[model samples]
Target chain A: MKLEEFKEREKRRKFLKEISVIAIGTAVGITTYLICLITHFDIFGWNFGLVLSPLFAGYAESFLAKKYLEESTGAVSAFILFIITVVWGFIISNPTLGFNIITAGSIIIIIQAAIPTATNYFLIGMTLAIISHISGIFKKITNFFYKRYLQLMGKLNLDPRIIREENAEEKYHFYETEPDMNHLGVLLLTLEYLPQGKELIDNKGIYEKREIFTFNQREELKSMRKNEMHLKLMASVKKTETKALYNLIKELKNDGCNAVLNLHMTFETLGQDKGENVRQIIVRGTGVVLADKTDS
Target chain B: MLLSSTSTLDNKKITKYHGLVNGEALLGTNVYKDLFSGIRDVVEGRTSTYAADVQNARDEAFKSMEAKAEALGANGIIGIKVSYNNLGGTMGNTILVTAYGTAVSYEK
Candidate 1:
């Protein structure tokens, strides 16, 4: 599709989404108002139920923005605040008071009557936005601690939904033949590590030939049993994999990727000349991100 | 075609090496299946349908990798690795399977 056409469609989609959010917010507001009326709840001569209208409206807007947009909470909240001000002003317009005041003063009096109502909504919106923003920060802190706890327990709880959406229309090149580009981006990683020393090394100079078993190598092997070395290698591999995955997440976050997909790890042993083998781990995956909501 | 998880075949010599090849398969579940699976877990202690679906996805991913290798004119694939991920959350409805390997031409 042409760029202009795509932009036009995106504009329309955003408009509709905003409208839906407003509708939901209004519903929550009206529900709260009705319950307040039924229960005869009041706070300092003002109906406490009325306060809930904008409070819940702001919460609903924040929740939707977090789940869908994920990155535009602040912008959406500001937009919703402006919209609610106008909407609440219109809803509370007193026709009798407007008619009475207009005859004595002017049409400006009618607008002046709506000012207090609009101001109340504006204050509520601002407070809600601030509260939501702080809550979002708390959620992030909690998630960080939770993930760290899981890692401490030797469980890597990586969520695939981190990349929630994938755009298949974009073209990606491959050396052989192009497969369906159902993912956002692709990466191939090869990690080489020394098992006994628990150290990582570069792949260079690996092809140099060495004797199968030197005396020093034999002594080292004798010091540590074959099974011990094997267990250590497995542990090292796990630790390396975890580190690589965390790095991938950080890189993808910078690249605006929501999640990783098609992730797999493969292992191979190079230079397996009796006890001096080099073990290599290969990690490959694609990134998936949120796509255009309208297109989906 | 000969496929092995090891880096080299038992006795065959590799004449040429092709780059990495990969395949991926995604399986989606419906609400009904999820509900029934929950009930089965409570009653039977197993959900056979999900297991079968996972196995099917793994097989499909392996097949896709093999096809990519064939397209590269490779007669053998080595160092094959397979991994599965649940897309969504703990009870996410989508499962993804990915398999990858190095393709090579080997002496018959």
Candidate 2:
């Protein structure tokens, strides 16, 4: 969408959220290991390093899932690492651990890491999935508790959660009514892109149009609502690269989306009618001004 | 029940041991779901149908296992190991799942 707005959205809050989640995961993992080491570390049947690998793998995966989103599913890279570790074990064991390669001693020791790695494969998948799920729950609980606390604090002349909600609500806006052409901050940008050579003009123009809508166009709707979901989607944009408006929607949400107006692009084939190297494009969407009261 | 696959739940003390309990289940799917999920994989981020399906099967297996523990008067389940078995390609293309764990009651 709006590259600048998207970049701005991505630059701070998402990064912080990612860091916070990863930090939480890292703390949980490392603390568990530290506690295990302090207490029943002897319970482990295999090398302690084996235990550590999978624990950290799952820990790393929590962040990986967040950072990479859908790309992190199945965690194929971890699988690749498993294969590499096994092969690396085959090559280095005789020299490193003084065991003949492929011998029972080597195999057993290798199995130590291999077993945990394999087990962690399942563990990591499930753990990451559950971690995401749990984080969502944690967020809900925190919001609930925080809201209650804020209300109580307000009666006692406190401003704690109030400030927190303010900061969280800054980037978001909501509108009840469909922003027609008359609405302030609503700009329908009709962009035409003519392809030069075989390469289509990149989405830079589309991104700019969105940025214009966000910082300049969006600020027009200054009054806020608690929910931004009431903001509607009306984009006619399509990309051969994606199934739905997947990227557009995600990027919009990621980039402090006030609302998403469907991108409509029209190509002019008149002058260059059927010219192999020439194509035109247009983009359209509503930039609604969020109303404090009833908008409709 | 305090279910966990980890060797121990974080900070949650395990006060006693109550032996082990297990549950196993096999689930089947139709060609339509399998085909749609296959196509969906290419289109979306997660195949929610398959995830829900597998999760439901796992939950069922765990529930049966918990039922066994409940019968034994146990309060919690720990150190659970879950495994998947396929009865397909000739065995009717069914999915078999097993959940086994030590049943125990732990103090807060």
Candidate 3:
């Protein structure tokens, strides 16, 4: 596909993907919030939106800015993400606020905001700005819980090279959001599943680069759960997140790779260590992209 | 015919005001589109076939309302009110939309 076509396709795909994440995260956050109300069990004293919104907002800003680096991005990027999150929080709470624009009550609310809400947002902003730079003991603490969660969930064995279970929750959220925004022509992959060859491949059953797969064909991918190759390939992608898969595909196409080459290069290298085989899956249009920074 | 959802017309003199004119639209969906929309609801963050379908139904209702006003020899309608009703069993597959306004002849 031409560069313009690719960009439009990717924009739509990313937009769709981000929206699904936001929707699902919001749903879970609200559900969790309601449960908290009923049970009076407040974990860390955070409302549901407060807990999940920042992570999702960060994920989305990283998407729009087309920049994401694990624990390496600077304050500016994190700051931008925090602002996005704050705005989302404001919007989510707006309806409940019931502001009467020109009243004394509004003034009192503003004063109250300057004291608590503003302070809280400021602190949260600072925390988010520095979140990506967490290191030393903080990093170790994070990694410990991460790994333990995964182990508890029976996804991974106890390996010392560890660092994750928020990931499990994220996927559960993703599954809930998948159907609503499924159209935007994105080739979505997850930590658990690979984009199987058979599902993504066009009916021609032949792999050729730049061939547009119909939406129905891409839709078929909803059932393309991971096999051994999918899991193995996911591990080989250097970066393990969904964005990494998007970027990898972008890199392949930028390097002028055909579909056959894209599949082989994507799956084969990842499967090399495991002696795993790649299945045939064809997808149309380059949907979502990780940042394709030419300078890097 | 001119249309305004607000109560008063801007700097216009009303020569004759007719009784309330109304239009109603009822719409349905096929299995495939509904199924597609059901999946779309889960997978998408915003925008859906159902939203589009409802918008279309509302537009059709508005058009019919305007047609009624025009047939009554009124140049404008004001203070329009629109209400939506879901007629289908529990899940609300069918929708009913009703629009009403005071049709009037006015001179600006």
Candidate 4:
């Protein structure tokens, strides 16, 4: 089989396996909930099976498979239990039709029950109003502390005085303000202003930001360190972390290395007249040339 | 010679083991530079002079380790670890950086 076809088949198999696992877990959870209802099981005036079956089933599946199940998979089991609860409530409310065998009238009754009632609308409206008011107050209170907390953490150096509305035409530098800004904001800003964005100064010169290397902190580091062969050591100190990493990658690529390992990066005060912060990135991975395996 | 901190090399078979190799570098700053660095540490929250010295020492140690591995007829070094120590005293004001790892020859 072709490589792409093989990979596609494998992916489909994996997806099917995951679905089966979730289905089994949900079935077990529902069975436990039914058993609890039939046995009248209760603990401390709470239905133990109803409350904990989904959680237990999800955990049990993960433990048995020797893997961490994603939160969505656990949610699937919980949602199934929720659907069972609704059906049980319907049977309790309309015992005559719900307990009876399937009929057109019973189907109609279920459809009617599924439709939102006037009381449901009122409850939803009140909940939304309460949530909006509470969230507005919460946002204001958190925004007040956010500046102070960031200052306490020594990450915020954004002086509002320096960013005057009158002098808003001047550029606002990210490096001078905060080393770690909202990464998504930086990405979007860069994308919005394309060719000139490489210089990192916007067209209007409003925000002057540096391109941050979007590397997976754990996964990329672990993979490169463990799997890549190293040939030469690459190290550089630049005005920005982006520059240092970018230069290191360029040098490594020039040396014919596909990956880097054992990276040690640090920020140090240059003690220059401007007291600029310089990033020192050292790559100690012995650069190795990956062999062409296709020929082999 | 290829040098890496990881214990193993990827996609390469070890043809020969050349045992362990090591390197050490000792560095000392001038008395005036040291004094200025100490003052700068108090005022600026960092001693750039000391930082530069440590960086130089680390590079020297790595270079020394690479030479030692080469001398042992090894083309690769694995499981490398670096350590830094300050030999403190009036006369013994020195910084020592040491690097050590296993040297091996791998398939080309």
Which candidate wins on DockQ?
1
lDDT of 1 by residue, A1-296 (tens): 69999999998987777667656656765675567657766534344444455455555665675565553333233234334433442345432222231121122122223453554565566467546564786567767985665464343222111110111111111122323222224222211111111122222211111111111235335423321222232233334443444455556656666533334564433333454444444444554453323422
Candidate 1, residues B5-63, lDDT tens digits: the string is: 77556577666555466666655443333554555576455466567767877787788
**TM-score for each predicted model, relative to the true structure:** 0.31, 0.24, 0.26, 0.26
Task: Compose the digit string of candidate 2's lDDT tens values, residues B1-108.
Answer: 777655454466555445445555545443223444554476563357556767777777788779867876768776576766442321122454556666666666
Tell me what fraction of the real C-alpha contacts between chains A and B each candidate also makes: 0.00, 0.00, 0.00, 0.00
Interface RMSD of each: 16.1, 31.0, 26.5, 22.6
Best by lDDT: 1
Off by over 4 Å in 2: A1-296, B8-15, B31-46, B89-92
In order of listing, the candidates' clash counts read 4, 7, 22, 7
- Superposed by TM-score, candidate 3 places the C-alpha of residue A290 at a distance from the truth, in angstroms, of 69
Q: Local error of candidate 1 at A19, Å?
A: 76
Per-residue CA lDDT of model 2 for A208-252, tens digit only, reads 222111111132122111222111110111121121223334444
Error in Å for residue A86 of model 3: 46
Error of 3 at A234 (Å): 54
Tell the DockQ for candidate 2. 0.01
